[model samples]
Target: MSGPFVYVPPVNPVNYPPSPVHYHNSPYLASFYTDPNSPFIPPLSLSGNASPYQSPNTLNSPLPTVLTPNAVPFPASSSGSAFAPENPWNRERRVSWNGSVAAPTVPNSSWLQPPMYHYRRRSDAAAFPFQQPVDWTSLSPYAPYRTELVQQSFIHPLLNAEDRRNDLILDMSCPSFAPMRNIGNNQTAPITPEELNQLAFYPQAYGAHIYCELIPDLPIDIRYRPLPGYSPIAPPLKVGDILAAIWNDMQLGISQEMWASLDENRELMISRAYTKRCKIWASRGFPSMRNAGVKKVDCLLGKVFFRGLVPTGDEANTLRMIVA
Candidate 1:
């Protein structure tokens, strides 16, 4: 059942179009009344309907020359459709003005959705795209041995002589006068707070001389010279042997040493010349002597037990361990 066509005046005449002008048309457009009591309605026919001005049996009266427009082609039949379109984004069932029937809820069930993204360790990057290799910058070959480092002293030690002498000679002629021939822990005094805090020292070897070395933790390319009497290619002790022997017990046994007898006397003397060139802990321990500076190693010529050098005159108490 449709309403009859009528010449209902546009409440706003300007909006209807001036006089007899034609207008654009779409299948989606609808006609409506502004006043509730108005009796006229536009013809229901599209451009298919004949114009009232041009023919008999046409739309009646005042709006006789209605602004009928030419229709555009429709995509589909307009049956069972509304003037307004269904929302393209309307994903769920919804109610309409006419009926209870609504669009079935879009099947949001798992069967209709895309499959779950499965992940596995694959050679392809897509599997673990964000994954990365181990951060080797944070790694090291000597990582395990790094625990040996201790807290360093911030304060400086009091001025002290770098080289000290001890009368380490034993006199067989005056037997009873000098009963003590062998040096022991009792000969050394207890450590003072200053020595422990300001100096880096091993308490066991504080007064006694034990072989010490400060090998650089980094790999170095060094062209070195062997001892005066030893051959350059086949020295008495090699880099590996020295490192192993020094670390074995710190103090190597005198009677147990199997060494080639060569310049024995000159080798025993850890003279001032050797001390100045060696890497004494006090020298290398300083920040100024590290990294960019040239570094030397403290080498032991003979075993820690072997003796030829000793303090002269009154320098007995401060018999500093001379490193050759």
Candidate 2:
């Protein structure tokens, strides 16, 4: 009680019994007393100067000293903190944003030459072949008719020459010369030979026959006709004369000079020639050109032969016509 009071926990009787217990009548005397057979108990002390008892093993061992931030020694290269110079083993390898290993910082290194890229040159032999030159004369309206005759001479083994020629002429006749079929009935009355012969005088029909020979693949409804109100400004020629000129020009190739002379008025000349022909056919007691439902067929023959003319208002709405 003379020094600072130290709390001592009561010894557990089950774990650390001081001595054997005995029954005694005297209340003042302790019921438990130290027995000679029991283990010895050390006396407790309360003195200020006395040291706490320790086991021999603990007394012989050195105590561990706690490290403080300032007391801790760092590597020579470090800043004397927990964040020391990074260990070479723990240092992360540098990489590029593209996931490639970054190049070393050393300049002009042996491995640092610019990347090699190879490009193959194209060979002259591999180049595309030039197309064969087109024959402008072959596009003439009479070309197919002439070709048919030539082909017939070689190929017709069954028919006699006279019979073959007659058949060819009959086949070459334009379908436009035939009478219009009734819409309600598929059957058409057979044409008399006289009617077919009389219809031959019409230049429009004749032109159509030639035009059909020129472009057999064109639909019957879309076969050629003259533009509505065209008139020849330069060389004033009749319909028959114009037709003859065209046929002759086709036989002998059209000259650049002729085209240059015609200039912007070529379409007008072509149109006027066709219009005059249609008028002549109409005046001669032949069915009027308008009666043949030819209004929709305003394609000029000159327009078909020429290239790069601006499309008319009506033509602009339709797909472009491909020149032969």
Specify the highest-TM-score model's number: 2
Taking the tens digit of each residue's C-alpha lDDT, what string does model 1 give over 1-324? Answer: 989876543333121111221111211111110121021122234454455545443343322223333222222434423223444344886655676667866544434543344445466877786778655534432222223555321111111123133323211111011112123432422223222223222121112122223211211111224445544462121212211222222211222132233256633443332344333423433232222121112124332321222222343112222232
User: Which residue segments of model 1 deviate by more than 4 Å?
Assistant: 1-189, 193-251, 255-258, 261-324
TM-score of each: 0.14, 0.17
| Candidate 2 lDDT over residue span 44-79, tens digit each | 345644543422124444343354422333445365
lDDT of 1 at 57: 37
Clashes of 1: 2
Candidate 2 at 312: error in angstroms? 31
| Candidate 1 CA-lDDT value | 0.27
Pairs in steric clash, model 2:
none
